[model samples]
Target: MKIVSSEGQFQGINHNRAMEPAHQPVYEMVTRTRTRTRTIAAGLVVANLALSGLLSKADNYNGNNTPPADGGYRAEACESAKQYHYEHAGFNAPGNTGGGNSRADVNTDTNWFRFPVNFQVHMLSTNKIGATTLYKAQMDQLDVTNSNNGAIMGLDPSTNSTGATAVQTNPAGWFIESFFNLNLRQSLDGGHTYTPQPTHVVLTNHNPPVFAMAPLLPPLGGRYGGETNSKIFFCTNFSSPCCTNGIIITNVIHTGFSTNFPPPPRGSNAVHTFSSTVSFNISMDNGLSFSAASAPAVVTVSVAHRTNDLFDPDTGRTTMVLDTEMTQLDISGGTLPAGVKLRQSPAMPSDGITTILSNGPSSYMISSSFNIMPELSLDNGSTWIPTCICKRMKHIPPPDYPSTCLSNAPLGFWRLNELSGTTAFNSGSLGPTANGTDTSIVQGDPGANLTGMGANNFAYSFNTTAFVDINSSSLNLNTVTVAAWVRIPTGFLSAIVSRGTNSWRLYIDNGGHAVFQTGQGGAAASTAPVDDAQWHMLAGVYTSSTFIEQIFVDGVLAGPISSATVPGNPTIHTQIGAAPDGSQARFFGDIAQVAVFNQALTAAQIQTLRTAAGGPPSSPTPVLTISPGLGTSFDITCFFGTTVQRTYSLSSSPNWTTIGSNASPYILTVTPTTNAAFFRLVR
Candidate 1:
């Protein structure tokens, strides 16, 4: 017997029905295969390399490279990009790249495509895409400079031009290891291969042949055959900090079939079908600004479940159209903080399809869409904008920090401004104008602009107004709280909030903590160390009148300074990125989602704000949410709350035994080593 129509709307699904209380489907097992490549020490090779240093003793590039005579690089989008490339990566884009699902887009020249250098991952999923596995690749940080290696230069990027090569040499002793995660779960082994399991789940890697194992599936124990999983990893080392920046990215790609499980014993009778979906979540304070986002790919999955009739089971048709409906939910503006925002737009090939499904009868498909984009925001939470809206800094360029050619620069957690008009604090009557000169410093020389990872870089004008003011009156607080997402690309840094004489403002020190300097002489009456490059949310609360300051990192209160005070009503000019105090600790990274409250928030309020941002604090005091999946036993994510801790792991099932614990984020094995487990913030 064949039939007709099917439709329904759902806020979320429940698995129960009838007289008996519905039993939630118990997770059979859980497993995770994590691949981590550490920073290896570069073996020093005594190759007396040809020297380009002007100084016979000190090795450094000549500080005076003529910047394209007249900034002539500012031609068409393509030409200017070309000059930027020559000036930075020192290479040209390849002509024709064989077009396909995995091939690079030659026409766009959008993202950097290098042979064997980048670790490309593709995923295929059966369930709506969730926070899947994270992908990473680490190499010995290599410093790029002219033949001389004397001057520290970056590739000058054209506004929104992803092709421009903007390279920045690391510090003298520090190494740069780039990292991004696989938020989407379509293909794991690389886009070239994919494996869909009977359980309707996807694996972490898509490499063909070993097609038998699923890397990111729940473990199978007392049930049928125990599950199988696999992973890959590599490491590199750099001799000096100057050339130690390497690429690490988390690929969020998913492709797969649909699978539905039987309703639990007594719960709701709602059968949940799984389909793949992609989303992004940005954070200001490490995971403090947890904001969910969608990618810009319209993926349609037409699913038809296989079923059989009881009485006429023998004669039942092979294909059964289980009553199902696939629809898109715009969760963008749903429930985030007042200063948080989100977006999900369609990708390249405009529009697609809408399907018609039937409850039971002729097999029909259920179509769905996955609309996501390079999400962007201007004001912390006032308005949401496209990634392109925040133009590239006039001086900073592409393949440098956090974006590709086709997409807008990622703020990561930092905030950026679109400089179409001019600066607010102008020195001359003519004011800040972008006329290809030192006066304006419109997008040209990397040496002139400050570039951060993703979107923290800013173009300066010697014109102080470039520093947005944040005073007691502008952002007053007797009992105040200050929060910002920052990235220090490189330097002996200091990001000032206000520069005053007697009283004062706050900032981030070179060591990565919050610093509140007050009472004249530029002394840090109150300061806390917080130096990791990843975006960190630092809250400084001057509760009551006395000089009592409590610092909170992520959700846990870091060390506090009891004698911290803002020397009473003192006038101070605010500086967002760099400290205006002649010390010149210009932030080399992005700053975003900045907020200053008049009143100090309790620990609970901060948690609520983080929850609204999408980052729910982890359990216990220090170990924040490393990784969380509903009923799974594996954990992913680095823990920063503890200065003495290395790695962390969690298990939801009592039967599941702990493998091992280390100080690194890569200790929890993703294999069936553990049964079904769920991990959450404990404290």
Candidate 2:
């Protein structure tokens, strides 16, 4: 039955039908939960923690990471990526990731061996059904950072989706939990010991939650077995938020044989499959600007990824070949041709893909799935020792926030970007919804696309008696993080996010001070006033390991409650903009981007998320221009919107005399202290 020929366009080769030739000895695929050791090929084992299914590439080192969960956004016939990594978890390369039956080289990753893109999610408790709503669940494709002309390979059709296309498919429940969180427990000491870390994966967001699981890539933390009966989850359940029925598919790939590793060695220079490195760009003036990036310190050698051929049943063989893999970027002395600067600043006003925060005068370490056990590492680009990649959260541009929330692999994160509906989708891995069905909580605020751009980003307005609730068991553990972007004009100690006063709560105190309540006897309040009629980010974090709770305002440590243990999560569900059950301490404010995590997020992660939410609306770095006035006086002009808030005021120093508030283009007549006196505008 296997007598055939392997020649030009050998019978088995079609993009649609991914199958190998019958004559040639097929390179068997191998897949196993490898820890300190990995297999290069069939029966070929190698040492060193490959970090398989952990961070970057697959074991054999293929650049393919696209899974069915990510294939819906796939484009076609594209070469270069608009940006290295869009803040949101999306991309467009060639065709869909040629997953399932074959691991081929479609448009295999090509942005160097390095890929950088964080995922952002907004929990939509209500069905997002507005004209302007992102329609995440029904998403086919939208504008990524810049590219929409590219393509992406998705899961093999062998595993049909049960929701949208049940014709010849079947989805499962593994998508939800895998999206929750993932951590790599390293054992640099030759597997003698490993990091004492436990991972609770939350692969949230529409269908096909994650692209790197099982057949996509061996589980990084190992083939996880369910907690209850000790069995690996392998089904596509559509009951959870984001994981609801949609266009995005949740292909339950079938895997049993590990004949060989995922990416078979294909090229002459391909030593091992994976290539890992960290590159950097030089920023001189703090974070204002940066020089071109150079990977002088990066220690890695590029390798060829897996390639895919097609199958044809008509001729008893196939004749079409396709590169189903997301090929790796070509590197030259650590630096690649493109990816220094992305998406012109003018292109994307809100959360533009600029080089502003991408560059640093120093090296930056990045760690995924925060608050996990993998913390320490010896990253020197020399010895491949277990190194914990850590870095201070990037400082966001003042007066603006990221288009979405900063979700560095959290248990749950609700961006609350839904324009209309009773639901704000949780963008984190957690598949829970943040329901705002309360009558007092109003959606679709006025001028949502303009004035409410940053502060709101389609935020929900909570009236005096309104509140929102969350449905999920992800937050039922010790060491938690609760953060949100809020604007409360009045100083009332109301709950911004709480599960009733008995459990934990993040709210405002008697004097506009931000507070984080751990329990009846443990609560931390900010010293200074934070409610000044503007939007501010409030974060509450409790570390069970240390039994400490902290409060942060606009990403700064406002107060820390040492030796404070968080009480057990109450039976009541989590709520936003009001107290749990909304029976007491109702809130009157605007809230957006609510993030909850089972593990305590680092100060930097919280700070990054805060800065991404416009920091403090009051502190804006408005541009001021000064020119020659009538004769002696100089005309100093700054932006003064006609809006009632943020009026402009002119003040000068001879003794610092105030010239009173005025409209934009106001000219003042004053002589110079020497030739010119410094005039400042305060709003």
Candidate 3:
């Protein structure tokens, strides 16, 4: 809970070099088979090579040429794993081609290794790679002991010591480990067991090191659960044992590219544009130790990429800019440890590559126009939703009856960071200067700190189980009507659910107006401020036959929240920013089209749904273009020029004209008995 750590921002946005996203080539880099190597003899010797099926190697323990054996692995801690590969990948063996991997110059053969067994990296999935690659699994050199103790190096550039082993725990060597893909792949029967590519075995440090273990708890503790506490980052210089360790991973595996297109020619249409940057790094004493000095994994990393479009020869749309960065340690002071405390959790499940389009026409749209879904409000700006519908429901688990349960939120209980703001949940400001104020900008360097620094923006952490089976189902709502779309900005004072009790809210009241607070223990409260910062469509209705409780701001009728009874009871369970005293006022500013109705809308149907909020009471929001025209489609009826009573194109131009007393240009036009005729309209 020590959060609030500002100081990293690095916006650079030029992005326009565009033209290298065409990968498919790989015609034949090298595809040989039949491989084998063996030549061992002496002390405790154990050799029994067979060729029947081949694929077995096990004897790992080369920490500087093996020596610790009383159970194994400790030979002086395996010679610090060759000082963790010369401080962390600067190359010194096999084929040295150093350029920008500098840890501390050492080239003796890039030593310090170990892999008797355990290797499964896997990654692949740019939706199947069709086109678009930026993979960064970072480092690898599997040899899991035996099978001729192999060496699959790649990442050449020009070759110097490609022997692959700078050991900063295999630092970016095998050149980001052969672009990821080691998940066992079929082949293993020799010994040391086998399971490497991130196969759950860690300890790669250089000095001041301090590794411990114990925390598990999770679907296997692949990490990323309430986190607990973390901080690790190290990379200084190494050619072979320069010493200065770090590695304590609880779990780290991230991949989110927004664009890298190049694979659509058969029928044409291979669009690719990527954007991903939501960074966060940590590793305190678990994996062994990490760098950036440790203490920065508040949970970042958001990405989205997609492609698949082409009709005849049209493959346009492709613009990517997703960002996320973390690796801090420009330190100057010093004071970190005693009981060890530093946590993070505001959003991180890891997902990207959305809708590559192209299954139909040359279409593929999911840009939200470009706002990207910002509008957050963790109790600061006021209220607003739509940051992909509030992150599609980050975890789900908030309305817990009375509150008090956000230990780490996320599935086990929900509360995915509810809402916060440095902007960009779709509020614009991709970073750099659009209003991020500069701040140093470095969270990932796309627009500049897209939302990373100091507790990462402030509030927002919800999960009310993502709203659905509020305990099986009982949502009658009582006489409903609740609308949204707000933006509060100044000091952003509370209430998008100030928890009046068994809750139901819509807030904004630091004088900016807009409020809706239904009851329970707080006495059924209600407000309708409508402060006027622009996007307004606040509502609140509860007429149960005039039980009174009406307040509409943007749709007019700015009155009636005098509530004496409508507290709510379809079974409680409703929370968005929480309030009624639970603690975190959430909901800062920006929400779009929120609704809840069981029936009880009047004051002109609540100003016709606030003049159709972003659209859909008639016109634009309703699309059915043409579909019901059998026999003229039943006396055909269509209404909606502006809520001419809502109803956009009803069919039945055939017959059924009751000719009632309530008419609206009743021109009565009917014909045919069966060809298919039927039309009726009422609001």
Q: Which numbered prediction scores highest in lDDT against the true structure? A: 2
Model 3: worst 10 consecutive residues (lDDT sum): 1-10
| Winner of 1 and 2 under TM-score | 2
Full ranking by lDDT: 2, 1, 3
lDDT per residue (tens digit) for residues 1-683 in model 2: 01111110011112222111121111211111112222111111110111221211111221112322433221111111111111122322222211111111111111111121222222222221121111111112111111222222111123211111000100100001011112224344444444522222111110001111112221111111111111111112312111211111011111121221233233222222332222333332322443443332111112222232223221233211111211222223444233321111121111100000111211111111100001111222221111111111111132233443443556566666667666667657766443334445677543212221364456778787676677665566567888787777787767888877567778888888998867665777887888786767788888877778889876678875756655676466777777765535878878876777777888756644543332112212222333345776654434442111121332341345556354543444445654333344544
Q: Which regions in candidate 1 have their CA more than 4 angstroms from the true location?
A: 1-419, 423-466, 469-472, 491-493, 510-512, 520-529, 579-584, 615-683
- C-alpha lDDT of all candidate models, in order: 0.27, 0.36, 0.26
**Model 2 bad stretches (over 4 Å):** 1-406, 432-436, 446-456, 581-584, 614-683
Which window of ten consecutive residues has the lowest lDDT sum in model 2?
A: 165-174
Structural similarity to truth (TM-score) of each candidate:
0.27, 0.36, 0.22
The positional error of residue 232 in candidate 1, measured at the CA in angstroms, is: 46
RMSD for each of the candidates: 27.1, 27.5, 26.0
Cα lDDT tens digits, model 3, 1-683, are: 00000110011111121111121101100000101111111100111111112111111112122222221221111111111111112222222221111111211122222223221111221211112122222223322232343332122122111111111111100101111111221134544233222111111111110100111111011111111132122223322232323323222222122333332332222223333322233344434444432232222223322122211111233222111111111111123232333222123212211112222221121111000112222233243222111011011111211021111111112112223323212121111121211111122211111111112222232222111112212233545556544444542445553224444455655565565545532222224444444445566666556556666765565654555355564544444444434433555443332345556566654543332221111111110011123464323222221111222233453324444333322223344454433233433
lDDT of 1 by residue, 182-263 (tens): 1111223233332221110111101000100111111000011100210000112211111211211112222222332431
Task: Kindly provide the TM-score of model 2 when superposed on the true structure, using C-alpha atoms.
Answer: 0.36
Instruction: Give residue 421's lDDT in candidate 1 (0 to 100).
Output: 44
Better of 1 and 3 by lDDT: 1
